[model samples]
Target: MVQRFDLAIVGGSFAGLACARSAALRGLKVVVLDAKPDPGARVRTTGIIVKEASDEFDLPAGLMRKVRGVRLYAPDDRALDLSAPGYFFQATDMPGLMHWMADEAARAGATLVYGKKFESGLEYERGVALGDIHAGFLIGADGARSRVAEAFGLGVNRRFLAGLEIECEPLAAVDGRFLHCFADSKLAPGYIAWMVPGVNATQIGLAASRPQRPDLGGLLRRLKAHFDIRDIRVTSRRSGLIPSGGVVHCLGARRVMLVGDAAGMVSPVTGGGIHTALHFGRRAAMLVADHLGDRGIHPVVAMTREAPRYRAKLLLRRLMDLGPPNALINAALMTAPMRRLAQRLYFHSRGEKSESFEAWCKAFEQEPDAKPHLKLLT
Candidate 1:
C-alpha cells in the first residue's frame, strides 16, 4: 500500500521543519523523514539568524541570545565596528527550537518519522522508499549532500566557504552582545574568522575558501591571542560548508523541490543562508499547496520568475566579493553615507519584496557595475 501525502519533506532540520509547519498550517498533509531521532538535528552551525527574519518566522524569543553589534578586525589588527538598531540573536537552544517546530507540525496534523533513510530506484514510481509506500510531492531539505535531489537529477555545483571553530569559555571582557570577526591571509583566505557569542561561552571559528588547505592550529592560536582569550576550556568543535555559488536553478522536478542548503541558497560573501532558506522553505510549501489545487508546481517558474530577487541580492554579494577583502571592508566603512544609501539602492532598489515575474525583469537591471578591485572606497 502506498502511503501518500501532500508533501514529503526530507531532512527535519530548520529548513525541513519550517517547510512542514507551513504546509501543515494550511491543512496540508505532511510527512517529514530524517535519519536522526535526536531533538536537535546537528551542531554544525553557529546558528545566527537576523532579528527581522527570526521574528518573521515566529521563532521563540527565549531561544536567542541577543547581540548588539559587529566588529571586524583586519589582518593588520585595524578594526571597523558597526551597530544596527536592533539586537541579533543566536539560535543556541536548537534542541528546543527543533522540538518546538516538530511539535507544532504534529499538532497541525503532520506525521514525523525518524531514522528513515530515503531510497530511490526502478521499483518505485517517484523512487521513494517508504517500505511499500509512496508520496505525492517530495521536498529535499537535506543538507549539501542530498540523495533526493540527485535522484531527480537536479544537480548542485557549489563553491563552499569552509569554516572551522571551537566553542570555549566566554571571554571575560568580550560582551556577549556582539560578534567579533578576524580577517587576514593567515587564519583564512577569501573568508574570515568569527567569534560568536553564546550563553555561557563563545564559539570561535575560522573559515576559508580553501578548507582542505588551512593551518587550523595556528588559526586557533591567533584567535586566542587576538581576543586575549585565556583559561580556555574547549567545549565543542565544528566544521562545515556553506554554499557560496549563489542560488542555482533546476531545484525541482516532476513532483519534488529543494530548499535551504540543498538548493545552494547561501550568500556569496557572508555565507549566511538561514534567512534565505527560511524564506524559500516557506515558498516550497506554498508551491506544494498550489500544486495540490491543480495550480501545478512551477519549478522554473519560481526560479526564473520569483527567485531573482534573491539572485539580485546575490548579485550584490558577488559584486562585493569582486573587490579584495580589505577593499570590501574599506568600502563598507568609507562609502559616503549617501553612497552607502546608493549601495543599498543600487542593489535592492527594485523593491524589498520582488515577485517571480518582476524578479526576472530586475535581473537585467545593472546599476553598480563590478569595480576593478577593492580600491579605496570610490
Candidate 2:
C-alpha cells in the first residue's frame, strides 16, 4: 500500500522541521523524509537567532545562550563593538534543537521518517517507493546541495565561501561572551575568520573565497599570532560552505516550495541563515497550507513583498566584491554620528535584518565615492 500525506517535506534540518511543525499546527498530514540517521551532525550553521524571531518559532529557551553584542576585528587589530539589543541567542547543542523540533512536529500530527531520501520528478507529486509514501505538495528544506532542487531543474547558482573550522580551548582573549570576527590578508582574501565563544570552548574558523591553494594553516597561524593565542588545545573540527546567491525562481513548480538554504536565503554579508531559515520555513508552511485550500503560492503577497529586499542586499554584496571599496566601508563604520545611527537602525532591523545587509546596501549607495566606508561595510 502506498502511504500518503497532505504535505511531504524533503530534508529534516532546521527549516524542514520548522515547516513540519508549522504545517502540522495548521492541520496538514505532514511527512518529512530525511536520508540521514543523525541529521544534526551535518549542520554547517553557527546557529544564532534574534530574540524577537525566536518567539516566532517557539524555540526551546534552555538550548540557547544570550549574547548581547558582536565585536569585529580588522586586519590591523582595530576593533569595533556593535550592540545587538533585544537579540540574544547562541545555540550550544544544535542537533538537540533539531530533534526537539522533529518531536514537536510529530506530536502535532506529523510523521517524521529518518533514513529515507527524496527523489524529485514531475510525475511524483507525492513520490512513493518501497511503500514509504507520497504527498500533494513537496517542500524542500535541504541544504545547498539539494537533490530536490536539482531534480526539479531549479539549478544552483554562483560560488560561495568555503570554510574550515576547528573547536579549540578558549583563546586567551575569548571571555565566553563575545563573538569576534577577523578580516584581512592573513586569514581570508574576501571572506572572514570568526571566533565564536561557546559555553566551554570556542569555534575558531575561517571562511574564504577559495578554500584551496593558499596556506590555510598559515592563515590559522596568522590568526594565532594576531590574537596572541598560545597553547590552545584542539577539540573538534569541520568544514562547510556558505551560500551567497540570493533567492532563485523555480523553487516552486506546481505544488513545490523551497525553504532555507535550498532556496539560497543566506545573508550576503555574514552568511548567517538560521533566522532566515525559520522565517522562510514559517512562510513556506503557510504557503503550503494555502495550497491545501486549493490556492497557489505565487498569489501570496509575502513572497513578492520580500523579493526586493533580497535583491538590494545581493546588489550591495556584488559591489562590495569590487576592490577599493573597503576603505569607504571602514570610514562609514568608524564615523561617530553614523555609528550611533547604525546601532539604532540595527536594533530595528532584527529578524529579517539581523545581518544589516539591505541597510548596508543603502549606506553604500548614498556615498558611492567613499572608500573608507566600503571597508566597514565589507
Candidate 3:
C-alpha cells in the first residue's frame, strides 16, 4: 500500500532531523528515511558545536563538554593561545547526541524510517514519490556526495577535504582546557590536525585537500612531542568527505529542496557545517510550510536568496590548498601580524580585551555547575 506524507526527508542526520522536527511540529506529516540501521550508526564529522549553535539550539548539556580556548601550534612546535571570553566550543558525544536528536524529532511527530536507502524518486506535478511513499515536498539532507543531487540534476560539490579521525580514552598528559590544533602542511596539507577532549573520549583527527591524503600516523608522531601516546586505547574511527567548494548553484526545484551538506552549506575554509545545517534546516521547514500551506513564495527561491556565498572563504581555501612551506610558517607564525590573523581566523573578532586564559579557567571553575574534574589535566 502506498503511504503519503506532507514532507519527506532523506538522511536522518542533523539537517534532516532538524527539518523533520520543525515540519512535523508545524502540522506537516513528515517522514524521514535513512540507510543506516539507527540514527547513531556510521557517524561522520567531529561533532564540534560552535558557540553560536549552542546558543541557538537547546542541545542536551550532559552530552557536551565545553572548551574555552584554542592552542594553535606552528610546525616547529611553537604555540599560540586564543580565546574569546564568552564564546566556547562544545565537543559532543556524537552518537548519544544523534540519538537524542532523533528522539526529539520523533517526539515532535515525525516518522523516522531507518535502513531505508533513497536510491531514486519520481517527481510529478503535485509532488515526489519514493518507492511506496508519496510526499508533497521532498528534501535531501544527505551528505557531501548526494545521490539526490545527482538524480535531480542539481549542482554538486566539486571541491572536498578528505577527513579521518579516531576516538580514544582520555589522555592524562594532554591538557583538557584547550582544543589543540596543529598546522603542519606536510602532515595535513590544506587543513589542520586537531585533538579535542570530548565529553567521554579524546578525538584526534585531521583533514587534507583532495588528491593529498591526511597522515594520521604523522599526526600521532608529532603529538608525541607534547604528550605520551605509547598505550593509547582507541574506541572508534570515522572518515568522510567535507565540501569545501561553497554552496551549490541550484538548491532545489518545484517541489524538492536540498539542505545541509547536500546543498554545500559548509564553510570552505573551516569546513564547518553543523551551525549552518541546523540554522538552515529549521529555516527550510518554515519556508516549505509557508509555500505548501499558505501559497507563499517558493521555498527554493527563498532558500536561494538566504544561502551563504562563501566567496572570501573560498579564496582562503585556495591559499590553504597550496600547502605553504613549514619554514615560512615557522618564521611568520610568531609575528605580530600573523598573531592577529590567527586570532581573527579562530575567534572571528568576537574576542574583547579579557583576562588571561588561566584566569578565565579559574573563574569558570568557580561556577556552581562547572565540570571541574573534566577541565583539569590528569
Candidate 4:
C-alpha cells in the first residue's frame, strides 16, 4: 500500500514548511497545500527574519542580507539610532526563501500540492475530508485570514491591522542595510511605517490597527512622501492583515492544530511573525509527533502552557497604545534610565526578561519576535 502522509498542512508558508520539514524528518509522511502556484508571486509580510531565527534555523544564506542597524524616528522628528554591537537582522528574499524552504520540505519527504486552496469547515465533519486524503493530523498555518481557523471552529484573529507595503527602487542616499522606521498618528496610528533594504528594491510599509478599515493606500502614499521616494517605480505591492491578539484561543482540538499567524503568534506591537512562525511551526510538529508516539503530556494541555508568555506580550501591547504616541516614544526611548538599561539588551537573552520593554522591542526587531516584560506588568 502507498504510504499515507501522517499530516496534511494547509498553506505552504514559512511556518507550514517548517512543520512539514520537522514532521517528515521524524519519519512521518506529509503533504503541504497552497493556493498560489508560485510561492513568491505575491508577497505579504516583510521577511525581516531576526538573527535569532537565522541562528535557530538553517535558512538559505544566499537569499539573505544582514542589516547593520536601525533608524527610528519619533513623531516629533527626534531620531534615535540603535546599533547593538555584533547584533544584526536579516532581510530575506521572500519568494526565493519560501520556494527554497518548500523544496527542502519536499526533500525531507513532504508532498507539496500547488494551487490547492483549502476551505474552512473541516471540523464540521471533524476533518473527515482530510482524513480521506490519508492524513491523520492537520496543521493550520495559512495566515491571519486563515480558512483553517474557521474550518477547525477555533475562531480567528480579532485584533489585527491592515498592512500595506511597496517594493521599490532604492531610496536616495539611504543606508541600504539599515532598517528605517517612522512613527506618526496620521500615517500609522497604533503602529509604524518602515523601509527595509532588499536585493533589487526596498520594502516600505505601514500597519494600522486604530480602525477596522484604515485607508492603507493613503498611508502608503504619505509614507512615500515622508521619505521623498514618491517618484520611485513600484516593483511589487503587498497587502495583508497582521494579527496582534497574542495566541489564539484554540491551538489543538481532537486531531487538528493551528500554528503561525493562524495561532495569532505574531508580535502585537511590531506586527512581525516570521520568527515566531518558524518557532511554533517546528514546535507544533514536535507536539504532534510526541502525541502520536505517546511519549509526552497531552498535546492540548501542553500547547496551552505557552499562553502566559504570549498573554504578557498582549497586555504590554495594549499598554503601549494607551498613551500619546510621541510621549511614549520619548519617555521610553529618550530617557536616562532606559539609556543605561539598553546596554544589557544585546548581552542578555529572552530567558532573562528583566530589561525595559522599549529596549527589548528594539532588540526584538533584530532578534526573534517577543518583547521582554516585567513579571509584575500584567
**Candidate topping TM-score:** 3
Q: Which stretches of candidate 2 lie over 4 Å from their true place?
A: 124-132, 169-172, 210-216, 226-228, 294-308, 323-378
Better of 3 and 4 by TM-score: 3
The top-ranked prediction according to lDDT is 3
Off by over 4 Å in 3: 352-355, 362-378
Clash pairs for candidate 3:
none
Write the residue-wise lDDT of candidate 4 on 1-378 in tens digits. 433567889989888999999999987778888888876666787888887899899998789877755666776667655555445678888899988998899999888888878874344333334534656678888999788778768768888878888888877645664687776656677777787877566887887774634445765665555566667778888888998787887776777777888888887866778888898899888887887766566556777785335655577568645534566766576665554433233223322334443464455556543434221111
Give me the displacement of residue 370 in model 2, in angstroms. 40
What range of 10 consecutive residues in model 1 has the weakest lDDT sum? Answer: 369-378
What lDDT is obtained when candidate 3 is compared to the true structure? 0.90
Q: In candidate 1, how many Å is residue 323 off? A: 9.5
lDDT (Cα) of model 2: 0.66
Displacement of residue 62 (Cα, Å) in model 2 is 1.8
Candidate 4 minimal-lDDT segment of 10 residues: 369-378
TM-score winner between candidates 1 and 3: 3
List all candidate RMSDs to the true structure: 10.2, 8.7, 2.2, 7.6
Candidate 2, run of 10 with poorest lDDT = 123-132
* Model 1 Cα lDDT, one tens digit per residue, 42-82: 56678777665777887776776766445667666666454
Query: Backbone clashes per model, in order?
Result: 3, 19, 0, 1
